[model samples]
Structure formats: C-alpha cells, structure tokens
Target: MLSTSHTVRRATSALLALSTSLLALALSAPASAEVIVRGTEGAPLHEARPAPGAIFPDEHIVVAQPSPSEVDPSFLGPVLLMKSAHIDLEKGTMTVPLRKGRLESGELVWSVLTDVTDENLANLHGINYSAKLAYGLIGKATRSARIEKDGTFVFASGKVDFKPEHAVTPGDAPNFFPPKSAQPGAIGDADYSPLVQFENGKNAVFNMPMVAFDASEETLNAMCDGAVDKTVVHDKVTAICPRDGTVTLQMTLGYTFGKPIFYLSTEANDPVVATLEGAILTPALNDTPFALEDAAPGESAERIYVFVNGPTGIDHPFRQGVNSALSDGGHGPLNVLGGIPTINLDYSPIWRLFPVLWTEEAIEKGWRTKLTNAIDIENAGAKGIVVSIAGGPPQAVGFLVNCPVVYRIN
Candidate 1:
C-alpha cells in the first residue's frame, strides 16, 4: 500500500482551514448561482448542487481556490462554494477532506464566483483556475524456495536471511500519452487512444532478487571439470567425493513469472567458463557468437548477456534490437531518438539460470541427459540429471539456495 505517514497530517490541517473559509463565504454570498468545476484539461468534470444526501468517494476530490491577487479585479468578492460550504477566494488556499463521503471525485472545485463581469468571466473558464487530482493503484508480492524442491518451498526450520540488492517496488508507470482534453501531464491514458478503453488494469514492474549459494573449493574444482555428483546431505565429505555418483542437485523452484532462471557467481577475479545446456553464455556483448560448437576445450561459456543499468559502453544485442525496432516504427516520442517508450523487457540485475558447463570435460562427457536436452553422445551418462531453469523478471518470487554450499569456495 502507498505510504500515508505525512499525507494524513497535512490533509487534516488543510481541511480545517477550508471548512472555516467555506462557512464565512456561504454566509455572505447570494442565495443561488450556477457553479462549475473543470479539470486540468479544461473539461467540465463537475458542477455544483449535488442531490440531497449524495455522498462522494473519499481521497478523490481536491479543493483549492485562487488568491484575490491572482483573480481579475472585476471578479473580486466572488462566492466560491463546494458542496454545502463556501470558500474564501481572497486567499491562496487548497485542501483535501480527511473525512469520507463529503464530496465526489472532481467536485472540490465545484465553486461559484458571484457577480462576475462578462469580460472577466472568460478568465475563469480554463483549467488553470482550478486544482488537479490524480488516482491510481500499486501492488506487490514476494516468495522464496530452496534447490531441493520442485514447487514453492516453505521456510520451516532453518535460519535464513534474505537480502534484496535492488529496489523491489516497481516505479510509477506514467502514461505519457494523457487525454488531449486534459493537460499533456504524466498520468492516465490519451483521451482518444484505444488503450483508455481497455479493461485490464495497469501494472508496475519491479526487479526481484536472486538466491545465492556456497560450495567447497574441491566441489567447485570438480564442477569446473564438467563432472560432479549431487549430494543429499550437502556436507564437506560429499563435496570432495560424491557417493551419490550423479552430477545433479535437487533445487526448490520458487515463484516466478515463467520458468526459473539461474546464474553462477565465483570469486571476483577467478573467472569460470560457464555454459547453459550446450550454448555458451557471455556476460557482455561482443562479436563472439553464442554457439556451443565454437567452444574450445576447457573454455568457459556464458549463455546469458548482462547489461548494466543506465547508459554504458557495453553493447547489448537484445536491448539494441528492441531500441532499433522502436525507432523504426513505434508510437509517441519513443519513435524519436532519446525517447524510448515504456517497455518491460526481461532485463534486471538478477542473473538468470541455465545449466552451466564449467569444464570441457563435462561437455566431452556427452551425457545425453533429458534435464538439459544436451546430448553430444548417443548414450545418457548420468541418472536423474536436472538442468537449470530460466525466467523473466518484474515478477513476485523469491529464491533460497543453500548459500553456504554454493559459494563456500568463493
């Protein structure tokens, strides 16, 4: 939910002042007069004199009045009324009701400035003469799992500490294309755009964190050789010698947008060759083609391409292609240079997962395993071999790997 720590206090003070001013104006104003309220776009969104007992939704109305100096001299002493209350138009004032059901959406500006000159009346017609209000929603979720389960995992016994490296809240997805009748402000859809008619609600995107694990140096070395055994107990003895004789680890898949993605992190300087299934994954973009056939013996392969946040010298083929496509035939300012439209790409700091082949020995093993669908050799080598998974971001999911078991070597 949106934080209201300061909004509550601030709105309270403003409402009290507004009520007092409104009461004073009502006592001095004419008996009746037509009053209208306009939005920032100059559209007539509200009018005075709601039916008796009519209740307005809370948090939707904004009340404000222009200062006497701001108003034209010919329209001075005009009676500005909203609902059953009057407003002192002489002061630069604004308010939002703390209570519910007093005014409807866009009705806070439903005011009357009595005895207005015909010439000065045109000055009060535009949206600049009123207050603007906006409305929207936000949602979020989080979950985690270990490598030993197939579905969502419950944190039952172990003491686990989860740390997020990036901001989890999806930033505001502003509608750059607002209604033409409204100001070209950030929020809502364009007046004539078809997206406004769409029923599905909008969503904010967020970058979730990936789980980390630790491993022993011997186990890491064994993994580097392209062959290792999966251990049930996950102890030091199992790291050095696999009694299970299988190069697979039981992982708990957490909640994800699609399939689970994985990545391997070694010591900062000690780079390890990594491959997903049979394809080489590179962290940065270059002339290097991501093909398994091109990998040399003992060479590390990277299946996923990494792009740093903000503008950088790093070249990302995927991001570039998307940018090019938008520039070629996209709508709004995004079609022009330096104006990229809002697109939720599968890009974030969290590293994706893929079955990594650390050593050429592992590739040479030619294990026809269904886990990765990678079989250089006709015969399958290991039983119960499980391949790594990949998933997209802006999803609400958590990953809990045996950190000590996966990163102990590092």
Candidate 2:
C-alpha cells in the first residue's frame, strides 16, 4: 500500500522516478477513498473579472462553498472549471510548479468585433479558436461549482447534478480525478501532463496549441467563458450540470500529452534502438538489481517492497529469467541498487555516485521496459523480481501520473 513502508520501497522503474522523501504514505492505493477535512487551507478562491458590461453584484454568490461532494475529473475539455474568489498572481509565480499540457483537438475560434464604443452599445469581435486540451493534471482541481462575479470559487456539490453536456457525468471526456469530489485520488498521486510546445504567453504547452484569436478580444473572452474555464474532472467523473446560462468569454489555455522518447539495447544488438512510447523509468524491471553483493540475511529486515508503477505488459526481464546476468539469477535490465553488477538505465548520476535505490536521471532515460511483474516480493532477495507485488496489474501498472518515484537510503 502507498501507506506502508514496505510498499514505499519497490515497484515500477518509472514509478520509482517520482519517489521523494516528501511523498507521504498517502499514495498507498490507486483509488483512495475520499478524505474530507474541514476548513479551507489549500483551497484559495480568487475573484472573477465581472462579465463584460455587467456591474459587480454584492451578493452575487453570498454563499460560496465547494460542495462537500467534490469532483475530480481527467484532463480534457476546453476549459478548467474553478471556484475562486481571487487567485494571487504572486502565489501562482511563487509556489506554482511548472504545470505541463498539450493541445489535442477543437478549432480555434478567433474574431474581431465592430461593436463597443465609449457610449455606444456595440460589442462584437472577430476570429476565435477552440483548442481542446489534453493534459496530465498537476495541481489540485476545482470541483462541482456555483461561481459569482465577486470572485468567489465554490464547489456547490450534492449527489451530483449531472447533465449530458456537463463535464462530470456519463460520456464526459476523461481527465485526472473522479467526479463529485476532491478527496485527492491519483490527481495528487499521478501527473496529468500533456505534451508541450513553446508558443503561448508563459512557458510550454501540453500537446496542442491554445485557441488564438487574431483580434484578441474573441480569444480572451472565450477563455474565461464556461467552455474554457468552467470545469475540472477525472476518469470516474463524467459530465454534470443541473442547469445552464449564457455568458461571455475571458482568457484561456489548453494542453496535450507528448510522445515518450528513449533508447534501448536488445539481444539482437540492434544499436540501442531509440523508442518513443509512454513515459520511461529507470531500473525498468522489478526483479532487477544493482549492488554487486546482494544484501545479507535478505534486505527484508528494512521493510521493503512498498510501491509499484508503470505501463501494462512490459517486463524486460533483466532482474531474473534469461535476461538477467547480475548473478543471484535475477532480471538484468533495471539497475536495482548502486552496484556495478547490473545495468539500470543507461544514464544516471545516482548510479555513478550513490549506493542507494533509484534516481530521476536513470528513469528519464526510458527504462520501464524491464519492470518485474509480480504482486509482492517480501524477503524475495535479489532472486527473481525484487519488487513487492501487491495485488495485480489493474491496481499496480498505470500511465505516467499513476506511476510514482521511489528511493532508498543507505
């Protein structure tokens, strides 16, 4: 379990790449039950810019609240629905990690308006682009909501009033978290990222380009519209909406997942073919090992085999079977510990200096192919897969965000 020390130790090579001492035991399960604590500590709401010509209403949203029932959805759709009073740009720059995303689909609606003069009631723009964003979600997502111009971000959650078009019911595009709740599932454990390109205002994009309007206003308004910044969801969550109303646009951005890249050396000696697939992790295989001298009396005394990760149906078998040559009759590919006995990922600063478990440098090189497929490995020694096999594939192996980083101290 993500909560157990044993689980904190072994698992997928790619998952091991995400491991950090700061990673709480909270990551024990794939779909952890909803955990709701009182008080809004991390949930900070930012005020919304008043809709076009509308005056700021006093009690627009007298009661602002994130419904007790939160909604965690996958990274899809045009905009990310949120309930915020006022987002602190300082916070966004200070604590915000570099979020990644990409553009997947949708047309960019760009337009220029011939309306809107000092005292004239004319407001129309030109050109607009609808950029569908696909991403590996990063920060905490806002859920079931009822917002106001007062900049109130609230999650008015209930049994989940879902409509067909709403992004949290049946048929809604898949995203990072589930529906009607913010209990922190893989949305926190996993990475909802999309491939990115340097084009927009900030850094990179997920995988697609944002809907850019040649005129500007059209793009800006569409961004703040419900179509763009109106929802946050995950896999378990579909579309949901008890009602609807029309509104103008504001500002926006989108995302997508990029292709994975790495190099591999096969038995055919094919010049280490470069492969592009999902994300990669070092010590590719579970049963894989590194240390020249296998730990004595079994390394189990330290409570091992804690966590696991990676894609399905991939085990290079470097830790055991015929693919292994690290003595102990284990698999070969994944470079387990910091020892010269085995070859983990082709590149790793940790492998060169430390005598520990895993490192980021190694996994970034695409070594998940050598994962040790199993449920648990208690006192399993360096023989066969050294990683602990908890239950099975469904619960273990997963995409990038689902996979975690791992580490061990000497």
Candidate 3:
C-alpha cells in the first residue's frame, strides 16, 4: 500500500494532468458555425470578391471597411480615405489602401466570410482602416512586414516611412505566465511566510500601520455622497479624506487547498469599503516593514495612500479564469504566460499591493456601498491571485477607508 503522503502526491499529479488535458481539449474545439463581417457600427457590409487564382481550402474570407470617423486618428497618425481592398482567405492575406483624397460617392463597402477563429475575430475587432492601410504600406515598402496570427503586421516597419507615432503592436497585450507542474499536496512549506493564522473562528492580530491617505473636505464630501473621482495622475489616483473622525476596518482571510477567502467589515457609522473583484492578493516579500493600520483615530489629514499599477493595466489569467468559471461552469481560455517553454512558479503567491482608486464618474456621483460576507476561492487553485478593489467613499470627505488585504494560508 502507498504511504499517505505518497498517495496524496499521486492524486495531486493526476488531478493536474486531467486539468491540463481538459484545458487542451477545450482550446482545440472547433470555431463557430458561421463567419460574419460587421463594421464598428454593427452593420453588415458587402462581401469581397476573391482573386481568380486565390486558394482557400474549406474556408472563406470575410471583410468590412469602417468609416474614417470610427477610427481614432491619434493612434494611426494621418487619416486618409480608404480606396480599394482585397482579401485572399486561403492565402491568409489582406490588402487595403488609403488614398490622400475623399472616397467617391456610391462606393461600396465590402465584406467577406472567412474561417478565422473567434479569438482572431476578437483581436481584430475595432481595428482601424487607417491601421490596415498603414500595414499595406509597410508590406509594400519594407521587407520586415511579417503578418501576425491576427492578420496584422508586427512592429517590423523596415524601410516604411509610414509608421505611426502611437501604433499598437502585439507586444502591447498582456503577457501570460506558463503553467507549472502541480506538486503533491503537502502541509505548510517554507516557501511562503505565514502572515495570518485563524483558529476557532478567531484571527491572530497582525497590526501594521495603514498606508495614509490625504484627508480633504472635498474627499470627505465625496465619500458622504457616494462619489469618488477616478482622475488618474502619474498612473495613480490622488484623493485624500480629512482625518476628523475615527474608523476601523477588518478583513478576515482564510485559505483551503491554497485558495483565499475574504470577509470585510468596518467600525465607522457610515461604512465605506473596497474589495477586489475577480482577483487575489498575496504578500510581497523583501518589501519594507509594512503593516495595515488596524485602527484609525481622527487627526490632521494630509497624506493618503494611493494605488499604482501599469499605465495600460495588468491582466491576471488565473484570476480571469476563476471569475469566468464561477459565472459559468467551464474553464475559460488558457493564457499560457511566456511562450511554450520553461514554466516559472516563483511569483505564485505574491503580488504588488495597492489602494483602491475611484473614477471621475464615481467621484461625481455618490459612492455606492458594496459589502460581502465571503469570496469564492474554489477555482483559484494554486495560482497567485491579484485582487482589484472597488466601492470606496466618494472623492470629497475621505476619512476612514477600507481596502483589500493579502494573507498567506498554509
């Protein structure tokens, strides 16, 4: 008979293998039944006439031309009138051009049916005609115009002088992390530091100074009325509440099989709290001595903590999959992080922590209250969770605020 530990290891391995196989099958499923081409306006366009010798086996080509108004001129440099277009479905080729003048009256906007997968269609959605015209110019003028999987040219502009200043390349998208081989189920390991321990429904108090937020009358008023402005400055939101009152917020964290559970509450008369939606937070090791303020006593409000992240925003594939799986009983897309090669498992339990920031609309309108008793962590598995907090006091009087907290559970 196998030892208990050995049996657990075997079971974990089998489970991971089964999960991987299921994921592969789901990814390999066939595309949608029909192919359609619609412009940004949601209207169907005319189909493209294939070239006499164009080759497409068991596939067709779909095409559409969006009006110049539909395109964002800031990203595509100068705007030009679309003149002509052609697409070869079998060859996986698209050719379009934009002349320096206006399109003639009664010009036909064409569309075609193609066998492209839905994933490719999603990436191609809202694609500007000017960008397509730029790609055509690059293909004709440069030797480095390699077409990407989504039918757009990569960053290799070659000798093409038409590269736009704000052109978006494939690198702009979120980079996924590779999946790791699941290890055997074991008790607490030395890899993760213990942050909180819960026993008999009580948590071991771990007191840390809370990150401060600037307290202002504007912030307080915004909070009271349920409005918090999301004005971004330097990729950060800077709104502070006056510290004229006292408030305390607590987040209860628990874990089972390497997943997280969160319960949030506050002691203020008017409770204002924020918790991440569709993400989890883990402690960042090697950071300075950091602790969340367990209690806040009203005093002078000058400094406030702000949340910061990348300008283009961050994407956590595992968290996204969890969110989708909770809504529907199926795993979503497989986001293979960095190509198909060596998988890194070092960043599995840690994420950069930040405060919840508000948007302009939220600041203008009174803040909305969002309270929850528990978070579903069944689908989190062993991947790192990146939590995104929402539902904080509005912009004016920002006194006691509640935000998401991270903890490590064995």
Candidate 4:
C-alpha cells in the first residue's frame, strides 16, 4: 500500500480521469478507488506526420521507403482494438472488457485485456507481438485454459485474492533504499500466473492480467457501480464498470530503449520489489528466478534494464537519476522495460530486473551519467567501463516484476 499522501495523490489523479457522473458518485460515496491515469507524462505525444517517400520502378526494384506513418502505436499512431476495449488518450485511461473465465475446479477466473496468441487477435487487440509464446506450450511457465461455449475462458489452474491490503513504507529519507514494510494488495495461489496456454488448440500463451478469482460477474459489476466495496478490485485498478464491461487500471511510467513508455505493474516475486513497483506480491511466482539462464527449460523471462550510474535530476536530457551509487537521495533506480523491437526482440509481461553498474574508474572519469541507449550502456559494460553487481552486496536490490508494456510516451 502506498503512503497516505501517495494514495491521496493517486485518488486525485483517478478522480480527474473519470467522467462527471463518476466523479459525482465518488463524492457521494465515502470512498472510491483510484487509478494511475497515464499518457501525458515524460513527454508530449506528437501529431502524426507524413514521411518523405520515393517511388521505384517495379522492373528495377520494389523497395519500401521508411515512412513516418509506419510508427508503432503510442507516439506512433492510434491502435485498433479488436476487442470492445477503448483507450481514451485524453483521460489517460484504457477501458477494457472485464474478461471472465473459470478454473478446472469450477473456480471463477476474471481477467482483462490486451495481449493474445494469434497475430490477427493481436491486431484486433492493439497489443504487442510475442512469437516466443510458442515456447510456453509445454512448461511450468504457463497455466492451461480452455474456452467455453459462450467464449468464456476455462482455466486448468490459477486464482488470485484481491482482498489483501497493500501498503509500503519507504526507507527513511535521503536514500529510500529498503522499504520498512511492503505488502502487495493482491495475491495469487500456487497455480496462479499470467501466462495462460489455452488448450483450445491455440499455440500461443495469452499473457494477460488476471484481475480476480472466483468472483461473480454480478458482484464485480456492483463493485464497479459503487453499490458495493471496490476493494474487490486490485489496488492497481482505478475504475471498473460492469455496464461497459470495462475495468480501468493504473500504469507506471518508465523508459524502453530511451523512449518513454508506460506499462502495467501487476505482480512481483519479491515483496519489496512489488511495493516499489506498486504491484502485487505473488509468492507463487517464487517458482520463477531472477535470470532466465537459471530458469527451467521453456520457462519465460525478459530483461528489465536498470542503470546504476545514470544522470541525476529531472532536468538532464538523459536524466533517469537512478544511479544507486550516487548520493542525490533519489530512490529506486530508473527501470528500463522490454527489448528494442526488431533488434533483440522479446517482449513479454514477465521480466527479470538487470542492473548495469558503472565501474568506479568510469565514475571517477565521469563516463556513466548521460548515456541513455540500451546498446551503449551494455557496450560500456562489455568494454570494462562498467560491470554487473554480481557476487557482491548491490547498491540497490534487484527483483522481478510482471509489467506489461502499454504504450510509449514520446
């Protein structure tokens, strides 16, 4: 759980993201849940512009020139939703359907958008593509699910408890190194995980958010309408509506390959890590490891880049200000999410936090502050300019987080 002040700020942000009717209802209610509305953070979204193009004769060559219009979703362009989900950029809220399914034991499984297995479904959902999902087919990394006659998902396993109260108390000022107490609001059972390998002959594992367990649709809808306690929703859930069959969640701001991005923080294997990322602490995920190299065959893991000596302060052009070795009192190093698409492509909700430590010599020579590109930072490590914090007490603790990339800011 966030401090009271943080909660208030988050609530205020959520209130601002909602419509007037919702706002009025919130005022009438003693308390209302909040969401972390995104979109306008880090940098402004640029208008789509036409790129210069050149035409080549078919007889000579058929080359497709790079067009500005070819930009990916986020700062690139609008994403088409195959599902009934709606993303409102102005409100920084994405209202996606409150998808429901069931477990083999007849336990209810509730979920939400956006990732899927099929490429066609990906286009329809406006989600990222992950061919690696095929690898999850025969592993402990994925849970099994089947589709019912009415299109409801029936899972073989996986259940979550949204009742836990989340709270986190950062370490005393200066450098909030280790939080005093950290508790994730929601928790999952031994069988629960986001990676779902549908037994419906689908070859892809649908990496989506599992929002609830064994909860009736009617109860969820009532919670959405504020007729009942909203705690039934995850702490990260900002708003929910059964009428619209949509649930709005909060997103965290970060950078991916030097580009500002937003992603959903859902679960973390470590409690402290969960608190820091505003995610649920799913001990069930303890089955996963910190590095993919150590994972069992077919196990899924993606790298989440972090800098140990990046520039500090909010004004620096490349300022992430997450250098743990530095003494600026800023806590939690800036986390880089996902891979550089088309380069070393592997995008999944599952992530392994990888830290880049600037060598003392490099720090002495002042070589680690302003760098931003992922390749450049890794290259610095390869060149002995920096090193991994392996085999020693780290400047900052590293842990895994399940944060699905949502969109880019700039």
Candidate 5:
C-alpha cells in the first residue's frame, strides 16, 4: 500500500537508518566460518534473455529430495527458478529450455527475485507470491529455493547466485516463436517507463528508486549500449529493457541525482529543472501516445523532456516537493526538469507574485512532497510519470529558496 503521511514516513526513515547501520557493521565483521546450504552448483552464466512467452522458467516445484540448507543468513528473491535458460552466440540464437526463441542481443533478462526470505534456520517459509522480481544483470545477490508439494517438501538447499552467463541453450519446442513469426520491433503493449513516486509529510520521507526508462530513444542506449549523460546515470546494475527492442539490457545505471525525484518530459532537449514539481507518472497507452514529433528551425517549442530527481508531492500533512516550480524556480535541491503539476494549491497570487518565494519555502521544508494520483499501478508493477514545465514570467524570477539536498534511495 502507498502511504503519504508525516508520521508513517518518519518511522520508516528511522527504521531504514537503523537497518543500514546494522548492515554496515555486519559487513565489516569477519566472514562466517560455516558451511551454509550444500547443493549442486548452478552453471556459469554470461549472457541470456527470456523468450517472449517462455519466461519464468523456475517455479517452486516439488522434489522427492530435500535441497540443501543455508548456514548463514542471506536474501532470496523470488522462489521461481527457470527450468530453462538461454544463451547467445555470434550466429543466430541458442535455444534453452527456459528460452523459447532467438537470442541475438548482448544482454540477459531474468525476472530475478531481487531479494528473498532469510529462512536459514531449520524452519521453512512458504513461497511468497508478493515478493517482487526484477529483470536484469547478475549480482552477488543470493536466493534460496526448495521443492514443495501437497504432502512432501525437499529443500533445493544452497543460495542460488544470479548469473546470466550460466544460461545454456536448451532443446527446441513447438511453442517457440519462429523467427518468421516474431515481431522484431513491435513491442505491442510492453511497459518501458520506470517511475519514482515520493510520499512526504512533516517528518517523513518515502523514496522509491528510479528504474530504467522504456520510453525514449535514450532508453535504448541505456538498455543495449549503456550510455551515461549529465542528467541520469545507471551506475547501479539495473535491468533495462526497451519497450520495443528484442533483447533486454542487463546493466547498472551509471548516474544518479541527489534524491528520488527525477524529471520526465516528451522532449529530450529541454533543460532539467531541479524542482519538486509533481509525481512521476505514466498514463496508460495502447501505443506510445506521445512519439517524438519534430520541431521547426528556430522554434523553442518541444526541446527535451527532462525529469529532475526530487520527492513525490502527495497532499496530506504538508509535502515539500509538491511546491510550485514558479514558487522558487526550483532553486531547491530535489527537483526534476520534466516537472509535473503537484500542488493543486496553485493560488494565483503566490504563483503570479513570487514564484521564487514558493521555492524557498519548499527548500526550507527539507525536500518533502507527495502527489496523490490514483492510477492502476499494482504494488510492484512497472509504471511511468510525466511533468509539465512553467512558462512566461516565472523564468525571470530566478530561484526561491535553496534547501538541503536529499539523497536518493540508491
């Protein structure tokens, strides 16, 4: 559930801080002199991708034998493991059980359960369907698996390390999408937009990390070639997939902003304004509604759609990031270039008189804002966001207030 309350956010922040500190201390401790789970090791994975329909290869299946057991505490993502996997070659595509068709791209896309339950003791926790998985590159991240049935259980044992290179081509199947029938560039209705929303209040901050964008041309660079510009960087290994392309980009973001708030725009050239304008959202579209339309020479219209990172301005106990960009021209830390209309309290005087002034107030509040939008986004479902820029006189006013810069949830 989404929360935008002051107290709720503050408590969460405290918990996060404490957890981070503890993790730091633990990592600094010596390695555990213990044998965790023992089981057959997985193959070495270099690069692989999921077939359009032949995905989610590994399921929590039942086994006649108990897997291994973990001796140390580790995170397990999704319990689902692909019975099949796919690999790439210079020729065409290498078919794997988990893979259905061609694999020409230089990337892999596994619906990796980012983190899993820490059931290291003698006890076992049933599969959690609510756990979220991400499709991306490999990491040291570990997950545990086991066989489950109505009457029996077998622990798959050991922590499963993610490795795209471990994917091997498997036998062919009748259901595999033949190269002749595949839609190369037609991504029909794939969701590529990754968004970040914030919930703020008097003493709370809810930060959602920004995933790779599946929308624009730059998104493609992020997926396949891996590009980093002044705006956003994929320094962290985030699974990037284009809405249209055949291969998925298993990569880490090279850059990041000061906060969770980022810019969003239809245009790619427009400068990004570091202001907490509104929540990043992606309205549903059967086909990408806003394509890259061209502009005439010397025309200042349609420059670029930039999203500066900041907070999601949800209304309820005074959110800071939801302030008017005109209020301070985004002289604040948490801001987005592709800004959105957050605060409905668009009082005429405040906007017309002192746009910069509002920005200062937003800054002094310490990067807090929340937008209340009721889209059909599921808890962990992929979503998008949009922001609108202010025009006319506000541009001349410069900035309102310079507030403390907030950190993004890296």
Candidate 6:
C-alpha cells in the first residue's frame, strides 16, 4: 500500500519550525571521539572483519563505539542487531530490517537502518561512517520526532510526497554540469530530514531512513516476494521485505580521498542538488532556509566534494572522470561525498554543492593532480590554480541532500 500527497507538503513549513531544535539535536554527533583505523597509512586493510565481502586491499575506517553511559540504546540504529540484516560488499547491497512506527496522527512510518550517533555507533550498527554529520547541528537540516511507548513516532515537522513523478534528464555530452531537468521522486517538506531525533529524553540523533509512510504492515510484507512499490518508498530502495522485515537499497559508487565507497542517494533540497547527485528534485526544501553560496559556517552545513580535474573515462582507476576537459556524454562525474570513515569528522545527508574547476593556467603548466581533501583544493585555489565555473571561486549552489554513507569499497 502506498500514499502520497502534495497538500501534506504545503502545510509542513510552519509545523516544521516548531521542531527545529529537536531535529538539529538529532543530527549533532559530538566530534570528540576516537575513530577505528585499519591497515597501514598507505597499505591494504586486513581481511578479517565482521562486514561481509572482500573489498580491494586498501584503507578501511569506521567509528569507534560510543560509551553506553553517553547514549541510550533506543536512540541508536537497530538494523545490525537483526539476524536477517546483511551487507554484501561485493554486490553493493545493504539489506536491513524495517521498523514499523506511526505518527501522532496515526500515520504509519516504516523506517530502516544506516543512521547512528557516530562512527562508533556506525560500527556497532554495521553501517558507513560520515564525519560530515557531526557538524549538521544548525538550520533545518533534520526533522524532529518522538517515539512513544506504543511505537508511535510523534513528528514535530517534515513530511514527504512520494506522488510526484521523479525524473532526471542528463544534458548533452561535454556539458553535463546542469542537467537538462530533474524532479525528485519523493518530495520532502520544509523540515523533512532523515536524521531523526527522539525527544523522549535521549540526547542523540540517528540517521534513520524512513522507507515508507502511511503504509500498512501487511501490504508492505508483500514486498518479501512481490515487487517494491517505488511510489510508496524512497527512490533509492531496490528491494523491501516487510515479512522478513528487511529492505535493500541500491548504492552509488563514489570516491572519497581516493578510496572507493558506496552510498545511497535519496532526498535533496533542490533540483541542482538532485542533478549533481543524480537524486530527486524536492521543491519543498526551499523552506528549510540555510545559508547558500558558501555562507554556511560552523554548524551550519557540510560539504559535497566536486573534482575539478579528476581522471576521466568510465574505466579509469580513480573513476572520478569529471574533468570538464573530457566532455564525453556521461551522465555523472560521481563526485565525492565529503567526510567519510577515515577522512574528516563531519557528515550530513544534507550537503551544499560546490563545483571545483581547474584554472587553464594550472592545466597548461602541468600543475594538476588528483586533489584530496579541502586543503588540497583550497591550496590550489589560493595559488590561482583552480576555480569553479566562470573563472571565479566555487560557490554553493543552494542545494542539499539527505544521503547517508552505507559501505566502503576498501
């Protein structure tokens, strides 16, 4: 069973404002914590681990588990605990148990795992770690919800309309920067965010992905054998089995500091957000109201990395092939999602898109190389080596996404 409504979005802005604090708190994961490191600095990671599949022998990192005294178990992601949940790194799939909860108004909200308090929590939950989320503490970056004793999630704000027809049209080759046009499959309201903060006296936020809303358990259980209803669930969902209580999501291959990773692209604040991420365009996000074009500072927003001159060709080892020079008719450059496992200490589903273009002089003088981390990008920029579109500084294009890191490809 599936349900969606554009009207629900029209009335969500004001309602979302009432719960900003809770949502903000939900996305906040303190940065002062140790991280899990594997393998030597430039060597392959050890093969013995809990996660499934053998990835390329490279660096692999996850967050350390948080202390029990600092967080409530209820606030942590529960997918890893389910016997049925499994992650197949070779096939690039994460199948987790679904959670059945309801809204205060009795609307059903079927959610799944992937969100955690921090990397430690991520490690415990067997999900990906995103350092970017630790800084998503301000603005309307997340939604507020309270889990009642009766399994009801009393939401303060944020609703989605899965009814809108989703579409992504790639531009002609050589200029795929701005897609022809795009429409997010599921449109979220002003306060719609995947980061769920339980206001039930828990000081933690979980990056929970709500797979279905106002859906019946019996109908959802049909997915165990039947086809998944894309109209009812998130677009990234590939398979869902309510009977077994597991949902599988399709992962996009990407790079972070030269390491391969797999992530889920679900909701975005703008059409450009959807275009760059190959995600859905959500118009209602305009109401969330955050600083655009690089004004977001401190706990305001996280970064979405774009390579100015990465290796080109789909078969390239680095696989980022997003250089403007290679104007092939490719649909995506597969830009990097900043602040993953061993990278930085910030992660958020909501991201601000900024294009990094290498200066002609830098390219001419053979100063170009695979730039890793913001410092590398910034240093090159300072030396007049790189600039975004129009020979100017790369600016945030008023876009954001609710993408959660799921798996790493070593």
lDDT of each: 0.19, 0.19, 0.21, 0.57, 0.21, 0.56
Q: What does each candidate score in C-alpha RMSD?
A: 30.0, 25.9, 30.7, 17.1, 24.9, 15.5
Shift of residue 83 alpha carbon in model 5, Å = 31
Q: What order do candidates take by lDDT, descending?
A: 4, 6, 3, 5, 1, 2
TM-score of each: 0.13, 0.18, 0.18, 0.69, 0.18, 0.67
Best by TM-score: 4
Q: Which residue runs of candidate 2 sit more than 4 Å off their true CA positions?
A: 1-193, 204-234, 238-410
TM-score, cand. 1? 0.13
In model 2, which range of ten residues has the least summed lDDT? 267-276
For this target, which candidate reaches the highest lDDT against the unseen true structure?
4
Candidate 2 similarity to native, TM-score:
0.18
How does model 6 fare in lDDT? Answer: 0.56
Q: Residue-wise lDDT of candidate 5 within 254-280, one digit each (tens)?
A: 111111211211101101121121111
Instruction: Kindly list the per-residue Cα lDDT of model 3 for residues 1-410, writing each as its tens digit.
Output: 88999999999999999999999988764322111222122135643322112111111222223322223322211111111212222222232221111112221111111111122331343111111111111111111212335543222111101111211111112321111111111111121111211122121111111111122344334533224342210001122223322211222322222222221211110111111111111121122121222122211111122221111211321222222222322222111111000111111111112222324443255331111111222111111121234344312223222111221110
lDDT of 1 by residue, 1-410 (tens): 54596788779889999999999988655433113222222125432222111111101222222423113322222222222221111111111111101011111100111111122221332101110000001111111112223422222111111121111121122211111221110111111000000112112211111111123334434643334332211111112222222222221111111111111121010011111010111222111112232122221111232111111111321121111212322211100010000111111221222222112344355432112112311112232222221222211111211110010000
TM-score for predicted model 3 compared with the true structure: 0.18
Candidate 2 residue-wise lDDT, 1-410, digit = tens: 26565565555543765565326544432221121111122225732222111101110111112321122212111111111111121111000011111112222211111111111111011111111111111222111222235523222221111111212121122211122321211111111111222222132111211112111234334433234422221111111111221122111000012101111111010011001001112111112122222233211101111122221222322222111221222111222222110111111111111111212333466543332222122223233223323322212221111111111100
Model 1 worst lDDT run, 10 consecutive residues = 332-341
Q: How well does candidate 6 score on lDDT at residue 93?
A: 59
Error at 41, model 2, angstroms: 18
Worst 10 residues of 5 by lDDT: 345-354
Clashing pairs in 4: 1-166, 1-167, 82-124
